[model samples]
Target: MVLRSSFFVASILLLTACGSGGSKNDSLPSETPEEKGESLYVLNCASCHGEDGKLGSSGAKDLSVSKLSDQQIEQIIRKGKNAMPAQEAVLETDENIKLVIEHVKTLKNKP
Candidate 1:
């Protein structure tokens, strides 16, 4: 009887150990660079700038008409342009900033 009880307790512990049943976010697949960039942009910029990036809230520029190159844009993002805040921490790395720049370019062609 003791052996059976021990086995049952071990099985319970093993089952829980094998499966977290944690937050859904934990189970999600890792985002690609492009997807990560898009998410970051939306979270960081879309509110005042608008989804198309032409709202011009608080002096934000219309990105579709932006003449700035990727390097220039990256600088502005890292350093801040007038009302916009510097995003160095949020962007976290040069590669992340570049990926976000590409997504911003797509907004230019989008309606």
Candidate 2:
């Protein structure tokens, strides 16, 4: 009887403790634009362009020395250049593309 009572008490305590933490989804901040871009880049571009954006795995351009403006970059991303395929299908949305473009700018080697 004592053993059963103790188990019931412990189970209640464990459940109460679990519920005290509150909602995990509310605790986390929404993904920032740069973070969103980094994730997308890793999924889509990092294989060829690399984490720093200069790997050029298959004739991809060296992004560190890239001189293209945001507009130019957008065009290239959507239209494709040389071995790079058009990203319109992959990127899907303008906002997604914009976030990636901003992150890519941060990769350039500053003069």
Candidate 3:
């Protein structure tokens, strides 16, 4: 009887503790253009571009030194460069592509 009672008490405590932390989607949304751009960059770019966006991987060019303009980036995403496949279908949304381009600008020379 004592063991069963202890188990019940523990279960109640565990459940109560879990419920106090709020639902899984309790976080606030990004409020600024830069913040949104960063979020999009992380989700779509960090894998190959790395956190700094300069780490060349699998023959991908270092974005920091690339002379590509925002328009070129958009074009590349829409139609793809040699190695990269066209992301028109994948990054179908213009907002996401624009945000990525904006974030990529931050990868300039680290001086």
> Could you estimate the TM-score for every candidate?
0.68, 0.74, 0.65
The order by descending lDDT is: 2, 1, 3
Q: What does candidate 3's lDDT look like per residue over 1-111, in tens digits?
A: 999999999999999888866655676663688787777767766667776877667666777777888899889878978877777776669887887788888777553
The per-prediction tally of clashing pairs is: 0, 0, 0
Candidate 1: give the clashing pairs: none
On the 0 to 100 scale, the lDDT of residue 76 in model 2 is: 92
TM-score, prediction 3: 0.65
lDDT of 1 by residue, 1-111 (tens): 999999999999987876765545487788988888888888888876777888888889988778888889998999997889998887888888888899899888876
Give candidate 2's TM-score. Answer: 0.74
Tens digits of per-residue lDDT for model 2, 11-94: 999888877666564777789888999899889999999888878899999888899999999999999988999997899999
The alpha-carbon lDDT assigned to residue 51 of candidate 3 equals: 68
Q: How close to the true structure is residue 52 of candidate 2, measured as C-alpha lDDT?
A: 86
Better by TM-score, candidate 3 or 1 = 1
